[model samples]
Target: MGYFRCMLRNRVSLYLVLAGGSRGNGDGDEATTPALALGGEGGIVADLISCLEAVLEEKSGELAFPGLRQVFMLNNKDAIVRRAVRSDLAMFLLSGWARAREERMDRYIKSYLDVSWTPVMSRLAAVAAKPATVTVLRRRRDPLATFNSVLENACSAQRCWKVPRPVLRHVLRRTVSEHVMPAYRRCVEEVEQPAAVRTER
Candidate 1:
């Protein structure tokens, strides 16, 4: 319909405006044309990213629709703008837009994801399904000291024996949530018990 066509055109204009990075002059005239502004490629690229993110957030539904999708795709390709001039700007913008779209889908739509983590999930499930036993040793006189000793020993064993150095390093450094540290702490709760207790004199 005419309405849809108009909507698509407006979306296309928004993309171009963002890509172009036009600003108004104090005299109320459109100053610094796209070509002129694009001379400073960094600013143009940053503006393009900001604009595309805003547009993607605003037009979440229409972007996924057929006609609008085609329009966005073709325009983003920028066949009209030669590779000599646009260089990789079109490609950069398109990739940013795609990421923005995926993030939007993940945030707004339930069970919708653009990435496949099936292998990771399967590995996690396999590890979790394995049977294991845990034992709390009353080695120290104080219960708290015993618990602390068990926790320390468990964490060291998990870090050094069970997990690879590189994976452990990355997980420890990058994992910011409260659960990550507590999950590491929970290692004490899952250790397999030994048949005999050994203590040094």
Candidate 2:
């Protein structure tokens, strides 16, 4: 039991990269957070997958569920421990991965809406500030490039997240449609509009 627990703890430590590193608790000293020290979002996610795979490989034979509907005799403490180890390890990994993904996605969304969108929106505001001729062909912001860059970042993050196949697909589809699509549409409209019409609004 102790050995199993130790293995579980080691696996989790590798998963989070919280062990074997200088760490900060986010208080104030300017030390790097564990996630950041581990090499940012992508690295943490990759480590998570690697650790999970390693644990599964190490415990495969012992982790098989041998019963139909689920039958575990309470009197058998060994059986209970085996069941707990398998189930608990899975739960811990999945919950931790989900949390990491959630935080990463939130950060990406905030960047998209705030920092990434700023340049184009600022240009739009500039146009709106002053009237101009429709055919002047003055230098204008290219939101398409910005939108594409943001989309690429989101896609890369999703690929590295490695949660589960179905969950990853759902997250990517929903995030792209909800966040990137609207910005894309707005960019298209702005680009197609004549200069005078753009600035007028």
Candidate 3:
């Protein structure tokens, strides 16, 4: 039974990659078009969702295959595939699969945010903390510039834009609480502190 389940998981993962047009090797390359000819078709989308649901419903008491989930979560390079997967996942959640897997879904969203936003936030934080050169000072002086730039780029990303409205709202709420608020607080403290004190620290 264990071996059978493992084989089932491997098969499902392969199907997910092909159905979602994700690259097989997990490089950051653009996702190839699914040769299954399942681009944005409702049937293929439903099948993908059903497969994911079955995996989530397993009695193992843990997510069966995280790599497969990551593939589904991050496969946004192709427009048709992105739309189909995004819409289908959203519908699956809305249709009540999320009730039992709420924590799992939250984890997925957090992982997505970590992947998509963490680097941008880290870079901005580094720029903010640097010696107050002309360029860095300009950015720090008007933090809105930094924030808006990040927001614009995030909104433009395929992964961010493809997220469903409800899921996006949840993501924004978490982002505000977990990242933006803390960062904004630090920025304010830094701006208000005397340069001598900051330098001393």
Candidate 4:
């Protein structure tokens, strides 16, 4: 397990570094690098996601479901492991390679959200249900702040900002909205507002 983990980490790091270094240098530049060439053909990204799916499958085999374990593995304490799971996954989701494998990428995106952003939104929804916690002022202003924080962390921590604008819009934005907006709307509606105070004339 350790050897496989180490090898995966090194390959991911090397590919990312090579890809970044090659960009904007010249026309047809990135394709010259073997790693980037494989990435262009969706090989590396596909393999990485396949490995993640295998890990999830193995964890699921231990019990009927392992949602918490999936979350823990994706958000692991080790920076390299965490980056490999979260940041690299985000890169793949927003890459041109994903366009050629839409169904696979879509499934991975759903799995990614099931483990990451969905839980945070669930907690927010739970908190919003409590009248004491979400006071009138908080209901009006604080939820947006909290939501912004969540959105920022979701994008920034996963390096979503590093992708091209069109890819980010078409892929990440749409996926986030589908998963988050409905829950956000529910939370907004569920928040218990305080009774209106009447002003004496």
Candidate 5:
């Protein structure tokens, strides 16, 4: 998990490098967030894929669902954690898109993109919660199934929706459950998934 997390950050850095090229710095100026800017050509996406290639070259381990992950983001996650999380998250996002395209689910599609509460996330949530009529016609998606269909992958189109800034700031926390965030809070501070200390049982 830690390595994957670092790789994500490093991948972003590598993307930055590619986007800007090796440039000279001013004596005391700060580097601006080039990736944060939207509506550009989205070159970081290419850099991100390049970073994933670099990471795979460095780390050699087998995973159950590399193919499915290529469809999502690269594997910046534990299989267990990711599979669990995906059960809910990916189903909603992907299925919604499919329904919108096929059955002309225009309203849900708009809500999915133009959400006000949590912005895009809320939109995705709404799309996920749509009645079966929306999804029953499209296709059967297990949502948790590991996909091995090797198609070309890119972070554009379906994967490139940006969260509106105001709504994003208001609901920036990843999960609503407070206990979900810091499992590392320690030593008399409570933690939900703390490492078990050995005791003479």
Candidate 6:
């Protein structure tokens, strides 16, 4: 138990150190502090995960966890001091939001999620879920396009043709579409940028 605890603590400290952002001063001190304080490794991990997830769900105007999920799993995501490299520097910059739509989202969706979608999320995630998916998010080439597609599907299946899926989906579609989409869209609009930049048109 002691060994596990030490190992965990070290792991947590490592995340903070890496994701902690900023390089040390000439004196070798950190330039910034991690967002959450952890007493134990587990706590650090949990809190950081929760904070990251919370940010995703709310669609706050900041990137939190994105293309870096893989990097995070590999324990390689670190906050950048600046946008020296677009992808790495802005991996956590919040993409499109989903909480600004017009429909009344199913609040029970989350409760249902704890038991239902979690498994499918990981299994068929590439085809069925979206980011902020508690289980597995369906993978798509373009996240924003994925967002639009999911919205269209939700409206169709739900037969409302209005509300977004995943209550946050609705919210983000609304606000994010209005606010962030223009810029983010332009970023993704560059088809030559990457394969995922297929076409939101």
Best by lDDT: 4
lDDT score at residue 104, model 3, on the 0-100 scale: 55
On residues 122-152, what C-alpha lDDT tens digit does candidate 5 reach at each position?
A: 3233333433323342356532121111111
Query: How many backbone overlaps does candidate 6 show?
Result: 19
Q: Return the lDDT, model 4, position 108.
A: 46
Worst 10 residues of 1 by lDDT: 109-118
- Ranking of models by lDDT: 4, 3, 2, 1, 6, 5
Report the C-alpha lDDT of model 6 over 127-175, residue by residue, as the tens digit.
Answer: 2333233222124344445545544553354342222225444543454
Relative to the true structure, candidate 3 reaches a TM of: 0.42
TM-score, candidate number 1: 0.20
TM-score, model 6 to reference: 0.18
Candidate 4, residue 50: lDDT: 54
Q: Candidate 3 lDDT (Cα, whole model)?
A: 0.49
For 26-111, candidate 2 gives per-residue lDDT tens digits of 56554343333555443443354445444543553363332200111111222323343354344333335445544544554444
RMSD of each: 15.4, 17.0, 16.7, 13.4, 22.1, 19.5
Candidate 3 vs candidate 4, lDDT winner: 4
| Predicted candidate 1, C-alpha RMSD | 15.4
Q: Give the TM-score of candidate 4.
A: 0.38
Q: 192, model 1: CA deviation in Å?
A: 9.4
TM-score for all predictions? Answer: 0.20, 0.32, 0.42, 0.38, 0.17, 0.18
Residue-pair clashes, model 1: 0
Q: Candidate order by TM-score, highest to lowest?
A: 3, 4, 2, 1, 6, 5
Model 1: per-residue Cα lDDT over 57-148, one tens digit each: 46644654222332233233232223313443443233344445444433431221111122223333332233231223334232234335
